[model samples]
Target: MLNRISLRQMEYFVATAKHGSIATASAQIHISSPSISAAIAHIEAELSVQLFVRHPSKGLGLTAIGTLVLQQCEDVLSQSSRLYEIAAESSAAIQGSLRVGSFQSLTAMIAPEVIFGFSRAFDRVELQMVEGDQEVLMNKLRALEIDLAITYDLHQGDDIEFECLATLPPYVLVGEVHPMAQLRTITLEELAPQPLVLLDLPMSRDYFTSLFAKAGLTPNIVARSSSTEVVRSMVANGIGYALFNIRPKSNLSLDGKRTVRVRLAGENRPMLLGLATYKAMKQSRLTRVFMERCRAYISDQYIPGMSSSAFFDRYVSGS
Candidate 1:
């Protein structure tokens, strides 16, 4: 009788016991209440024990035998989970569910090439993508909600392992008709007096502001936006100049307004784009393969949807 019990039945039984109600367990596990009740009854009948005592007002209380059985069930479930880990570790094939998280701004540009490309290359792997700011992605990594993150090296603690793929330095964006648009390169001092459109994101905001702080200059921020595209659009409309690391393939904003990318005159701190994963989590084959794909696709030489870094030298040097 015990041999006839499936892992799904055991899972249903454990969920019911933990929640103390079939309906509650069903809701949590996305199973029907009748299915949970049937699993519990089957387990109780097979073991010849009254697993739970029900009350009309109260939900259910575990019997002494149920308490003991619950412990055994939990242990069995734990062991059963290890089997999958063992198989994955031993298998050479790259096939499994890979949950990837990316910075919100990068997803639109980088996903088509790096993410979808990987899926097309490896047909067996099931890829799930999530996008958020640095803080959100870090939280997701720690909570096991995401397997890895595509982001910059920002506020990363010892618990995170980051691999650098590219170095992106800050540049200015302005409408084609802006006063500074004719200039190939501009300095922070020159930008200080201009009305700025700020990218107001968590760690990103701090990083951008810190550059001004280090140069002992204050930006005259006339506008702020959390979305990168919004900031670009504001700049294109001649509202204010903006700073950004990403150089979109097109100089045109989302609304088809023309914008210019002016290189910063002096060397500043460049953001390191990289892969971030939970330090303690062992890399699965799928994760390893995905990381490999990212490395092959993105680098100092080239990035998916951004202009090449080589052009930065020609612009800043006035060559």
Candidate 2:
């Protein structure tokens, strides 16, 4: 009888899929390239399905079946790491590695409160955090690199589950000396004529632009940047007014320039801040406890962040 598929094969397959090529996977996992290739070939022969499309010049691409298989392999590896934790749970102590990911734009203000606080509470858990854009975070979630992700609920599907912790309403950001800076509330119609500094990230950009469309006005966008701080600094430097949902703890820009946060008026729907996890994936005990910490921190922190400044308009009339 043919030898059964091995755990080592699954590990090699997962590494290969994550790194995109045998050579790169070998380098990452400290395995020989030929060994990795042989392991993948044996699995393909056993399963009778092509896991990856060979692109000599370009890198490996997953076949449709391979995409599904990758999820299984990742889950297996993730669970293997958690096995120690599960075994240790008999001692009534929650101690293990907790890997996490989050949106890059949200790291500064969020990391200290959530990630740091969690670490303090769970003195035994080893926490790992990786910051990336929305696409990168989603990819990591699918690949099981993170136990769970703290991110905006911009996209949701059957493949993932998002639990909303807070709602951030969109608002206008302006320079400290701008004419509208002192206003308690300003409508999109009035702000549309001014030069705009767009944050210009994928889903976020679409959401901000859609606000103008709903108001039946066209924005005169003059400057755009993918970096959140770049857009904020531009606004602080009088480049243009920008729209944002998250309110920083301070009004100062990266370079110490002051910016004003004005509450937006009209029918603006809030963006949800939430935790995203893969559907059907097993949650570790540490993950469950960390999730509770996340919920509690956001419960207290979200409202305060919104209420601390002019960024969110919870009380302004006609908002």
lDDT of 1 by residue, 60-167 (tens): 989999999999999988986665455446546567788999999998889998998777766667889999999999999999999999999999899999999889
Question: Per-prediction count of colliding residue pairs?
Answer: 0, 0
Could you tell me how far off, in angstroms, the CA of residue 65 lies in candidate 1 after the best superposition? 79
Indicate which candidate wins on lDDT: 1
Tens-place lDDT digits, model 2, residues 66-144? 9998898888768855754464564354678988887888887778767876677557778999998777788888999
lDDT of 1: 0.83
Alpha-carbon deviation at 40 in model 1, angstroms: 67
After superposition, the stretches of candidate 1 with alpha carbons farther than 4 Å from their true spots are 1-92, 315-319
Per-residue lDDT value at 231 in model 1: 94
